[model samples]
Target: MNQLTVFEQREVLGKEFRMYGTPEQPLFLAKDVAEWIEHSNSSVMLSKVDEDEKILMLNNVYNQVSTHGGVRKEQWFLTEDGLYEVLMQSRKPIAKEFKKEVKTILKQIRMTGGYIPVSAEESDEEFLARALVVAQRTLSKKDEIIRMKDKQLEEQAPKVEAFAHFIENEESSVEFKILAANLGIGKNELLSILRNHRVLMTDEYMCYDKTLGKRVKRYGAKHNVPYAKYDRFFEVKQYPTDKINRVKVLVRPKGQEFIRKSLVKHGYIQERAA
Candidate 1:
C-alpha cells in the first residue's frame, strides 16, 4: 500500500545493501538464478524478468510451472505469497509496501542461507578477561575475611597461650601456678620473675633467694601477697641449719647419727651408719 524507500531497506539489512533493488541503487545479481530457483526450499526466488535486467522477479509461484510466456511481467510481479514472506523478513517500513515486502523477504532469505555459525571459543582473551574480573572480586572478598580472622586471633593470642601453659606445667606446684590460675598473668611475666628472683630448690620444698629479697618483697607488696623473710619457704623441715651445713659430721656429738646420715646422703662422708 506504501512506497518503500532506499533508506528503509538499508535500515533493515544494514549499509551493505544500501544500493540494492532501485534505479539509483542496483541490487546485487545472484551467481546463478536458475540454480537458486531449481533448488528453492523457500517459496521465493530472485531472477531477471527483462532482457535489460533492470526489472527483476520478486516471486514466481504460478509462472514457474506455466509455459505461457518466458519471464513475463506476471512472473516478476510481487504475489500475495511473496508479500506475506516479505513482511516476515523485517519490521522496517518500505516504499510500495507490497513490492518492498517481497524484496525484504528475498534479501533476508539469501543472507540467512549464506550465514555461517560463529564459535564463541574463537573470542579467546575477550571472554577470559570477563571471567577473571568476576573471579577476582570473589577472591578479594575471601582475602578480607581471612585478614579479619587473623586479627582476632592476634588479639586473643596471650590469653590462649596462658591457658595452654596452665594445662601443661602447672603441676610443678610453683607459687606462680597459683598466681596464674587466679590472676591470669602471661608466660612473659612469670619468666621475668624466674630470671630476677633467687629460687631455692629442695626435694618437694620451696625457698626464696637471699639476693633478690627487695625485689620479691616489692613484688609481693604490689600484688597483695604475704611477704616473709623467705620468698620460697620449704613445706617440710628436716635438719638444723648449722649441722646440715657442716662438712665433717663427726664434729657434732649430740646428733652424730643424724650427721653421718646427712653426710652419706649428700656424698660428703661415705661411711654407712653402724
Candidate 2:
C-alpha cells in the first residue's frame, strides 16, 4: 500500500468537499467540493483508501474521515489513515481498492438528496437557535473572544424582541448620558458592560469616583494592585505623563492570530501575546 503524505491525502479527499452555499441542492460531494478539499490538503487526503471490495463506498468514505481533533483547532479535518480505518470497519461494502472506492463514493454522493430550503417570509425560532449554535461553535477562541461573542449575542438577541421597546422609548435620562460622556464612553457602551459583565443593573445609574461607586469593594479588590488587573493595558500606555491616554495608545484588541501576523509582516506592530 502506498503511504500518502498529509498534503497528498488532503488533495485526494478534496474531491468531496461539501457545499455551503446551496441548501436545496445540498451536498452531493460534487466536483467543486472535491477541488476545494484537494487544493486545501493536497497529498494527505488521497492515501487513506483501502480495498475491501464489499460494502457501499459512501458509508465507507464518511466513516473513514475523522473530524474530532482538527475541529477544535479550527481545521475540522480527518487524516487519510483515519478515513481508511473507518472504511475498513464500516458496515457498508468497500471497493477492491481506494481508487475504485473513491469513485463509488463520489457517485453515491451525487445521487444523494440535498437540504430542504427554509424561507425568509417568516422568521423561524429553530433556525435562530441553530444559528446561535453555529456561531458559538465556530467562534474565534482568542483572548478577547468572549467580548466579541457577547457582542454578537447582544446584537442579534434584540432582533427577536423586534427592538420596538428600545426604539419607542427615549428613556435614557440626561444623567446617564452625562455619566457615559464623563467616562469617555457612550451610553450603549456602559449598558453593554453593565448588562453583559457587571451584575449591577439599576434604573438609577450614575457616574462617581471609585470610592463612591457601587460594589466599590469588589471592584477595588479586583483591580487594586498596580498593573495587577491587566498588565498589557498599562504596558500599551504611551502617555507623556503618568496618566495613560487611550488616544495616544491604540490597542487593536487582539483579533485573530492572522491579524497580528499581518501587522508584524508590515512592521506596524509586534507580537506581545507570548
Candidate 3:
C-alpha cells in the first residue's frame, strides 16, 4: 500500500545520476549517463546506442526531476541494457569505476529500498563492509519467499486429502473379474460365492443384433446386482458394446477392502498388513 517515488537523485562514486522507475526496473537519464562516462559532444555518445534500448519519455511524467526548470516536453531515458551499452563505449580510465558505482547503487536500491553513497572520507574497509550488508539482505529476501511458499502448501493439505478420500469412497472402481485379478484371487471362486449368496445375478435377453441384422437371444452376463446395502460395496453400470449394450458390476476401492477383510476373517486368505 506504500507508494514508490518515481525520481531518485543518487550520487554514485563521486558522480551523480538521476534514477527513474522502480528498483526492479530502473532507468536513467541519458544525458547524465552520457556526461558521466566522459562522452563530450560527438553526439554525447548517446546516439551510438541502439534505437530499441533508448526511450523517449514526457518530462512532466516524473515531475520531481524537473521541479527547478520545469520538465521538457520530451526527454531521453536509457533502459538498463542501454546504460550498459553506453558505458562500454567510454575509453576513459574512470569509466570502469563509474560502471561499478552505477551497478552497486542500483543493487543497494533494490535490496535496501534506498541508496547511501560512499562517504568521501570513508576508508576502503568501510565500503566493503557496506557492500557485504547488501548481499546479506538480498539472501534474506530469498529465504523469506521460500518460507511463504512452504506455508501455502501446508494450508492446502486438507483439500488434497479430501480429494483422495473421494476417489476411494465414490469414483474409483473396477469390473468384477478385473477386481479379482487385482486382488490376486480366483475369479470363479469369488463369483460362485456371490451367486450362491444371491448378491449378484445373471439373465438372458434378446435384442436386434447389428452384425447379423436380426433379433437374437444373448445371455446377459450381469442382469443386475442385487443391493444389500445400497451400492456401498458395488455399483451396477450399463455401457455400450460393439453392437448393443451390456451391464457390468463395478466394485469400488472401499468394497475391495471390505471383501479382503471378509476373506481374512473366514480364513480363506491371510490378512495382509499394508
Candidate 4:
C-alpha cells in the first residue's frame, strides 16, 4: 500500500507542522499537533498524560515510521476531524488561531482540487514524463521571448548597420560622424549633439546697459537665428575662435535619402561603375 506523502508545511507558534496525504484526505503529524497545542497552552499538561491515553489518541490517527539519518522514528498523523477534536480539548487562544489556519489550508486545498501524491518509488518512465512536461513549458516561454527579440533586431538591423558603416569609414563626412557620435553610434566621440542642440536653442544672452542700469537681453541676428541654422542647418554649434572648429550641416532623417541621392547625382559619394 502507498503511504501518505508530505504535501505541505506550515508554521504556527514558531513550530513547524507537516501536512501529509492527498489534498482530499489531508493529515497532520500527531506529534506536531500535540507540540503546537502544548506551546499554545502551557497549562494543558500534554507531557503528563499517561501512555494509555497517548496510545488512545494515537489510535485516532494513522502511524508511520519515517527514516532520518539512518534512524527510524514512528510518527502519528491525524486527520482534520481528529486534530479539531484535540484542539477543542485545549482552552488556549493559540488553539483558536491554529484552527483558523487549518481552515485556510483546507480551503486552499479544496480550491486547488487537491494534490496527487507521486509514488515514493516512482518508475523511471513516470519521472521522465513529468520532467518532459515541465521542460516543454519552460522551453515554450523561452522560445517566445527569443522570437520577440529576434523580430526587434530584424526591424532595427538597417538603422544599426547604417550608423555602424557611417562610424567605421574614415572618409565619411564630419556631419555624419558628429551625428553618429551624438546618437551613441560610436565610442570615440564625446558630447551628445542632441543635448547641445537643445541647449544652444534655449541659450539666452544678457548684458548690462549703463543707461538702463539693469541687465537687458542681447538682441542680435545670430541670437534670434533658428536652431536649424546654428551651424548652417547642421544643428551643431561651432565656436568662432583662432582654433578651426569644423562645422558640418545636419541632415534630418526624412532628408537623408534625398541627400544621398543628390550626392550620387553630383558625384560627391560616387556609386560603383556598373
Candidate 5:
C-alpha cells in the first residue's frame, strides 16, 4: 500500500477531520476522529475501551509508512465500518451529528472521485489538464451559488423594507390619510414637506448616455455626474409600489415628528407644554 497522504480536511462544528488515502479506497485517521468526538462532547471517553481490544483493532487496520527523510511513522487509519463502530459506541448526543457529518464527507468524496493520484501510465501534462478541468468546474459551482444568493436578496428586499417600516412605526398609531387630515394638508403636500426636510426620499430615476449611443444606465441616487448635465438623457422611472409604500414618510414615526414640528412652527396646531 502507498503511504497515506492527506487529500482533504473539513471542519465540522469547530472540530477538524482529515481524509487520507487513494481514490480507490479512502481512509480517515482514527486519532483525529477520536479527538473530534471528544472535543464535540467532553463526557464520552475513548479510553474506556480495553487496551487489548484497542491494540487488536489497530493492528488489523493501521499502516506504518516510511518517509523520505529516513523516518518511519505509524498512523492508525479507520475504514467506514471502523468509524461507524467508534461513533456508535460513544454515549454522547453529538455522536449522531458527527455520524451525519461523516456520511456527508463520504458522499462528497465519492462524488468528487476521492483523491486524484498520479499513475505510472499517465504523463505530467495529462494530470495537469485533468486537474485544470476540476478547478474550472469548482469555480463554476461557486459562481452559481453567488447568483442564487443575489436572486434571494432581490426577492426579499420588499419584505425586509416592509418589516423595517413596521418596526419604526410600531409605537405610533397614526395612518397617512389621518395624519394629512390632522395637519389640514393633502397627502402629496405632506410627502413634499417631509422630502424637503430630508425626512423622505424622492422617487428614483435611471440615467442613460444618449451622446455615446450606448445604454450606460445609472441609478438615480448612485449617478456620479450632475443631473442638470444629463437631464435630457435620463428617463423617469417610478419606484416599485411595494417598496415605495413600505418606505413612505407618513408611515414612519420620524416623519410624524417632522410633521408635528412643522405644524407647530406654522401654527397649524397650538404648541403643547414641553
Candidate 6:
C-alpha cells in the first residue's frame, strides 16, 4: 500500500507494521500479521497460504534496509485474501477483532478508491491502521485516463501476444500438418474442413503420369488450379510414385494467414486458451 506516512514512515505504519502493495490492493507483512494473530511461528502460519497470495521481498542496497545491515534479508507479504485466511486459521482471541478491523479498513479504502475518510475520534493506532490506503483523489485526469488505458491493455495482453505469435513467424512455407498444429487444429480435422469448404477435392480422374505412359487415376487438386481464391496460397506438388498419384499440399506464409482467417470465419479453427 502507498500508505499515508505516519510519523514519516512510507513502508511502516506508526512502526507497528510494514505494508507493501498498491493502495488499491493493500498487503501486510506476514510477521506483523502473525504477531497480531498470536501465531508462534510466522513460517508455519504462512505455509497454509496459497502461493499466489504471498510474495517475497528481498532487502537490497537500493532499499533503505541494506543487505550489509544486520536486518533480516527477506520478508513475506500476504494479499488481502491470504491475510483473511491466516486470521481465520488462528485460534487467538484477537484474531477475530483483527479480521474485523482489517475488513472494515479495506472496505472503506476500496469503496472510496483509496481515499478513505478519517474520523475526529480516530486514535493514533486506528489512523495508522487505515493508512494502508493511498490517497488518489489528487491524481490528474490525464493520469487517470492513462491508468484506465493501461488496465485495458493488461486485460488484452493474452490476445495481443497470440496475434504477435501468429504474425511474427519467419517460415516461408509450412507443411499442412505443421500449419494445422500452429492453427490449433488436428491434421485430419483440417483436411476434412478443406474438403467440406471445397478448397480441396478428392475425386479420382484419369491422368497421364510421365513415369507411367499409360493413363492413371489421380485425385483432384483444385487448390493448385485456377479460379480458386485460396489457390495461390497453396503449393500442390504431384507425387507420381504412389498408385493414386496424389498431390501434397503446402502453405506459404501469406497463405497460412489467409487460410487462418478463412478457417476462423467458417468456425473451423480451434481457439487457444488464454
Global lDDT of each model? 0.33, 0.31, 0.62, 0.49, 0.51, 0.60
Give the better candidate number (1 or 4) by lDDT: 4
Q: What would the per-residue lDDT of candidate 4 be over residues 53-108, giving only the tens digit for each residue? A: 33211111224455434333334455667677677767777888888777776675
Worst 10 residues of 1 by lDDT: 246-255
**Highest TM-score: which candidate?**
3
Question: For residues 141-248, could you state the per-residue lDDT of candidate 6 as single tens digits?
Answer: 338755754675575456445644865764667687877776655777666556545666646588888897788976564433322666787777777755446566
Candidate achieving the largest lDDT: 3
Q: lDDT of candidate 2 vs native? A: 0.31
Candidate 3 regions with alpha-carbon error over 4 angstroms: 1-6, 42-44, 61-72, 117-274
For candidate 2, the TM-score is: 0.19
Ranking by TM-score: 3, 6, 5, 4, 2, 1
Task: Please give the distance, in angstroms, between residue 156's alpha carbon in candidate 3 and its true position after superposition.
Answer: 43
**Clashes in each model (backbone N, CA, C under 3 Å)?**
11, 29, 0, 2, 0, 1
Candidate 6: Cα lDDT at 131:
59
Residues 1-274, model 2: lDDT tens digits? 0111111122333243332212222222222322432334323333333333111111113333323322210111223333444345333332124435444444443443211123576478876665565445433332254574456446544432332333244243223343344333454543433322222222233355576655421222222112233333222333354543321221222211222233233222222222
User: What lDDT is obtained when candidate 6 is compared to the true structure?
Assistant: 0.60
> Which ten-residue region of model 4 has the weakest summed lDDT?
53-62
Return the TM-score for candidate 1, rounded to 2 decimals.
Answer: 0.18
- For every candidate, C-alpha RMSD to the true structure in Å: 44.4, 20.8, 25.3, 27.2, 27.2, 18.8
Local accuracy of candidate 3 as per-residue lDDT tens digits, 1-274 = 0111344575655677677665777777777776787676635576888988776543333443332222123356787888888877778877788778778878867766556676899999998788777668656865775685466446544534443354455557877676555544567666644554455674668899999999998776455474565368887778898977876787877776676555444333333322
